[model samples]
Target: MAKNTGGNSLKLKKFLNRDNTVGYVFALPFIIGFLGFTIVPMIVSLYFSFTNYNMISAPQWVGLKNYVRMFTEDNRFVNSVGVTLKYVFISVPLKLIFALIVAFLLTRKSKAVSVYRSVYYIPSLIGGSVAVSLVWKQLFSTKGLINNILHSLGMARISWFGDEHAAVWPLILMAIWQFGSSMIIFAAGLTQIPASYYEAARIDGAGIVKQFFFITLPSLSPVILFNLVMQMITGFMSFTQTYVISNGTGDPNDATNFFALYIYNQAFKYFDMGYASAMAWILLILISLITFIIFKTSSTWVFYENE
Candidate 1:
């Protein structure tokens, strides 16, 4: 019995010394964080979504009441969903196109290209900040610099935020202005294409445009898909610019009332924590559905070298 017990201890020690065991030990902190922070918060929020909880009072179970109110009773919820979809669809595509164009242009061999890339990327680094949003608000104000430019060009100075239709444009434009990260990704993709492919295309009389369409685009499709999904997620969650610009009122008849801003207003402004939690879950579901659709369709467009 003593020899058998010593043999079992030796086996256990070997198992613990294995690479997988060591790796798990190193990864224990991240696993703890993921469970404690992410999973726990998500579970709590899911519970709260079905309750009536203000910040001050104990949460009362309300079942599907919060979700029912969101769909049937809340006009603002409907408006916010519409506004957020519009912003995402318009701004994400434009940002991707602009980023690709700039990346393509910057690929030429030149010493100044690196400097230009850094300068262009600065907007993305600061674009989401309150100060930058404030600057953008002023730039698009009725009597601001944009109106002054229009006046100089013999065009009528337009009301940017007063009109419901026009109010969403400034927010969309601001979203498009932060295309630097996508541009950097595209630039990296462009560099990875083998020179031999371009050489063969050139030998076959393929012009620049043809090479771009046939060679460059196909090779970069995977990167494009990645940027598309990431940008879509970011666009749906946009809040700071709208909050700062519209003063959190979603003003001019709620034209710029993005989904995230509406969630904020519900949680903090109205003190409706349960409803806000429901909205957040809905946002998560919407984003997941979109991401799933993109990934499912990606096989048709996203090329991989390994395949």
Candidate 2:
């Protein structure tokens, strides 16, 4: 009996050893890379958020001074937050709605469906680029393409970038034009919805609107939630288009000033690395909280067919 127990223990030890070796082999690269690149930087940044670390000088511990200053003293930070919220609220829903409409159109059987999808998606690929923003800046200039076209039609040229109120509309338009990513996601979700449901609805004398509201929407709720969350995050973090369009100043009157751009200016332009780190942490918290709220509320509205 003692020999039999000893043999079983030996076998168990060998099996455990083999499993450990294989697990380590598979995880080694990820562990090394994460520690080297992500974990270390995250730790460093957290420490820096409590200090005064300009690039040229050693960090001086400042406690919560940076955070307090941001909340109390920085009007720019407040304005940027407001601007970011506005952009996120306006752009995300519009983009998602437009994408859904386009995706629905694309799902129809048509000879030019592929071409239309390609054309719609092209804007998304190009829109976020600095080069594209530069082109947009020119095109929306008082003497640019849009104004020129209006002039050709004997209409007065309107100020697009000159006025602060009007300047933001161009950026909003640019964001709306890049609905392709959301459209692609919606298209995939639409494809996953069974055609049998639509056929049954049609047999029951349901119209197109009825089929969409009852059959299509409930089925695609998960993808809609996904796109909504992603678009909100992306719109909130938007910087490049604003930076390129405003030439990094967030002009005219800082109307294009976004939260990420504000952080960038704080860190690099003003050499307020510690303050910028604090702002980054704040942004991280904001995004996490918003995402959490969305997920928490999702159970009420987001339909999971498999469940």
Candidate 3:
């Protein structure tokens, strides 16, 4: 019995060693790249967050000065935070809702379904690009396509980029136009939902609206949660559209000065590396905390079909 047990242990050890070897081989590129790029930079940035590391000079330890200054001295940081929060709160839900609606529409059997989906998704592909933002800037300009159409319709032209209040709307519109990713996710989720459930609800004399609220929404809760979390995170981290559309200044009284844009300004524009690193870490913490809260709250609403 002892000899058999020893033989079994040896076999298990060999199997485990082979598995480890295969895992390492599969993970080699990622491990090497992570250590070389991501891990090293993270470590360096962690250290830099505590030090004044202007590009011209060696880093000097500043303890918590950067963080303290950010909280107390920097009004811009506070304003950026407020702007980011507003953008996130406004854009995320609109994006998710629009995506869900489009996805639902796409799920219907129509000849033009794929074409509509493709058209909706095209904006998302282009919306984040500098070229697209430039085009959006042009389109929202006083004499541009949108205003020209409004003018052609006998309406007064609105200042899209000039007015602080109106300037943010263009960004919001741009975000809403890029609902493709979320739409795709919603489409996938819609497909996973069993048609039998809907059929049963219909047999029970449930209308489309009733079936949607009771059957569709409940079934799509997990996807809704996923899209919500992702949209929130993406909204918070938005930069390129604002940067390109606002001409990299976050102009018109800093209305478009998102948190990430503010961090870029701090790190690159102003050479406040330490403060920028602190802000990056703060944003990281904020995202992590928000995600954790979502996960915690998900237990009540997120219906896992497997369980």
Best by lDDT: 1
lDDT by candidate, in order shown: 0.94, 0.89, 0.89
- Report the C-alpha lDDT of model 2 over 177-277, residue by residue, as the tens digit: 99998898898899988899999999999998898889878898999999999988888789899999888888888788889999999999999999999
**Which residue ranges in model 1 land beyond 4 Å of their true spot?**
1-16
TM-scores, all candidates, are 0.93, 0.89, 0.90
Residue 271's lDDT within candidate 3 is 97
Pairs that collide in candidate 3 are: none
Listed per candidate, the RMSD to the true structure in angstroms reads: 2.5, 4.0, 4.5
Show model 3 residue runs off by greater than 4 Å.
1-17, 152-155
Worst 10 residues of 3 by lDDT: 102-111
C-alpha-based local distance difference test score of model 2? 0.89
**lDDT (C-alpha) at residue 168 in model 2:** 78
Off by over 4 Å in 2: 1-17, 109-111, 149-156
lDDT of 3 at 50: 94
